[model samples]
Target chain A: MIGRLNHVGIATPSIEGAIAVYRDLLGATVIREPFDLPAQGVRVCFIDTPNSQIELIEPLGEASPVHAFLKKFPQGGQHHVCFEVPDIHAAAADMAAKGATVLGQPRIGAHGTPVIFVHPKSMGGVLVELMETPKGDHH
Target chain B: MIGRLNHVGIATPSIEGAIAVYRDLLGATVIREPFDLPAQGVRVCFIDTPNSQIELIEPLGEASPVHAFLKKFPQGGQHHVCFEVPDIHAAAADMAAKGATVLGQPRIGAHGTPVIFVHPKSMGGVLVELMETPKGDHH
Candidate 1:
């Protein structure tokens, strides 16, 4: 079951610029600096919002999943909604049992958080991401 | 200043279908039922998450904002992020002073909640919505 709304992912052309806007204009504080996740071929930055955080995603390579997204929707925009779960594997298995297609096997995401993506086809054409915060990572 | 992320807005083809996916499959419960906002030309349903809610938006008319988005993207996807603010008018003025273009004057949104949107171009091309919860409407 979902524990919380972890973060909302926004795909942007430049993480630095996004960070600046959220920080300076919107009064959001930078929670984390840009970090590269080579496996996902993307660089990410987090901005602290009131109740949750805003994740800025910038594709690092041509093969990044976001690359295709950018091509189809040139306008950078909201990308995904990630829900916090107690156990990623169990949540994914439950979803699979309910006829949802799991996009990838559970794997370590940014900052060693266990994450899995649910296919858009099974969720009314909206991509959903589920993440389980590692033990002792609570802020 | 923003307090926390209130919700993430997702544009979907069918609000009913999205409700099933978020509730039955993803373990999100429906804290709010479908509500129509004629001014915005969309119907919305909210799925409760611990930190925030996932707002599913369905365009009601051809001229609806989500309608145009769907026409261009075809695939339903994340639409916008709403940040909770203590004062809607103050937040809008502050954002405008910081060079962000306000979509329109702050107006009552679904459930009579005051809300305003900032232009995507001014916010790193990601549409950002600001909302102020009425004192008596806190959930």
Candidate 2:
């Protein structure tokens, strides 16, 4: 059901510092400017790769999950791996039926596409994000 | 210069248990049989997706890096994200020149491709793996 590896989310204490690694070191030329998503409680930016993207996420508030991750690791780390699914609703349903814990209802993700998170416990302790590929961008 | 996301490595205590989740829960039909990579000090298997894969890694011995990860988290978690680079040597040199710690030297990775790892400290604490794509598989 997974289409492509959409983006790998990295929880960072400082997005600017992480951006430097991708920009100055990796020579990534198409990094989108970072933006805050209050609803998601994080600030995010996309570092485009040849086939996918690296998502840098920083906590926007104390209540943010990224905040807790930062508190635990201080330096931050890989937070989640997102994969594109052709249909979010069906993916979630399939996961639920097969005993995977779907976090919540499908909601608009950072890419403006419906997405749902699978509980880490059910996915070998790696948080898995299932996103419906935006129309016309399907692979 | 990343080519594509080859795989997201997930450290797991039990490969069998993780395989069930990918097979029964996600309905992945192209799961590769688990194999032990004694050189890498881990047992691994590829769960193929449309565009990439989920590499399930389990510690093979006390010296395994996955052993350390499991000790810290117990439940296991995302180990590292591997991105394909057209030239692993150049990628390592480029990262080193930019002050990123390229761990050790490029060695044969699970996919039989030359791969190098970047230290997490220089990458916002997210361990990044850069691998040269196998010939004839360029994207």
Candidate 3:
């Protein structure tokens, strides 16, 4: 159902600090400037790699979904893994049929793509996000 | 200096159960048979996706590296992200020079490729593994 590893989301207390590691340390050339997604309640940025990208997410407010995660982890950690799917609707249905919990209806994700999150409890504790690949991109 | 995402390491208490999710739920066709690596103190299997892979790892003994992780998490979780690099030695030196703690010298990893791990503390709490790509495969 999944196509490719779109990006790996990493929760962090500070996006700037995370950027430094990927930019200065890892020598990543394509580090997008950080931006806020108030609706999602998180500040995000992408660091491009040879194959995929790393998404750094910081809690934007108390209501941020990542807030509780950061509270328990404090130091922050791997938040989730997003996989590209050819069809979000079909993927969601397939996963649901296989006894996975679709957290919510498909919503516009950070990539401006339709995405749905599967409850981590049903994914062996690994939070999983299935995203619809943008039109024209062949995986 | 990362080449491509070779695999995502998921620490699970039961590799068999994990395989079902990837194989049956996700419709993964290439699910490698589980094998024990006593030296690494773990049993491992690989589920290949279109772009990368999911490595299901289960602690083999009390001394397994993932033993403590499972004890703390209980439900199992994403343990680390492994990236392919062109040269393992150079990657290690570069990371070390940037203040990232290289866990130990490069050693043969699950894919029979040389690999080194960077401490989670230095990587925004995300344990990172750098593996040298197998000869002849371009990242």
Candidate 4:
């Protein structure tokens, strides 16, 4: 079962600028600095909201999925809503069973958690992400 | 000071359908049903997340600002992030003092709370909202 919302991902052209705006303008504290995830072709920084988090994502390469999202929707806005789950693989399977398109097999996300993306078509055009906490075996 | 993320507002084409999707598909419970806010030009339903809430907004009139936002950005998606504050007026004043554009004077919001919206331009194109629990006098 999907749990609480972990974070809202914001796709930006420049992570540095987005960070400054979130921190200075919105008074949000930076929970993590920019970190690269080569497999995902992006770098991420996390800003803490009182109850959740705001993930800032910047494409590391032209081939990145985030890069394509930006190219298609250049509004510099919300990218996805990630929900915490106990088992990403199970959640993805369940969603697929319910006629939702699973983006891919569960993989390690930037925070070392297993995660998968659900296509927006199943969610009324809002991209939904499911993430699982790292298990002892995976870590 | 902002305490935590209060909720994320999603502008949807259909409030009932959206509520059903969140409840049936995501296993979320409806904390509140559709409530009309004529002053805000919208009707909203609240679904509880583990830590926060997802507010589905359905605009009541074509002249509503949310309608304009939908017209400009046709994709039904996350609309704004609201932070819980101790004092809405003070927070709005502070934001305005920091060169951010305050959308309006703090007004009574849903659940009898005082709320104000910060302009998207001030927050890197992401709309930010500040909300305060109403004091006894205001309530």
TM-score of each: 0.91, 0.94, 0.96, 0.90
lDDT for A98 in candidate 3 is 80
Q: lDDT of each prediction vs. the true structure?
A: 0.81, 0.88, 0.89, 0.79
Query: What lDDT tens digits, residue by residue, belong to model 2 across residues A55-120?
Result: 999999899989998999898899998988889999999999888889989999999999999999
Q: What is the DockQ of candidate 2?
A: 0.71
Clashing pairs in 4: A50-B4
- Model 3 misplaced regions, further than 4 Å: none
lDDT of 1 by residue, A1-139 (tens): 8877878788887787777787788887556878999999899988776567778899998999988878865657778778788888898889999999998799888758889998878877667888997688554
- Can you write out model 3's per-residue Cα lDDT over B25-101, one digit (the tens) per residue? 77778889899978789999998877788899999999999999999888899999998888999999999988889
Tens-digit lDDT track of model 4 for A1-139: 6577788888888888888777776666646878999899999998886567889898989999889988865657788888888888788878887788889899998668889998876775678988895565231
**Pairs of colliding residues, candidate 2:** none
lDDT of 1 by residue, B67-105 (tens): 998886566777888887889999999998888899999
Task: Give the lowest summed-lDDT range of ten residues in model 1 chain B.
Answer: B22-31
Chain A TM-scores, per candidate, are 0.92, 0.96, 0.95, 0.91
Model 2 per-residue lDDT tens digits across residues B1-139:
7667788899999999998877777677888989998988999999887778889999999999999999987878999988887899999999998888999999999999899999888877888899899999744
- The TM-score obtained by model 1 is 0.91
What is the Cα-based lDDT of residue A114 in candidate 2?
95
Binned by DockQ into CAPRI classes (incorrect, acceptable, medium, high), candidate 4 is medium
Q: Please tell me what DockQ candidate 4 reaches.
A: 0.55
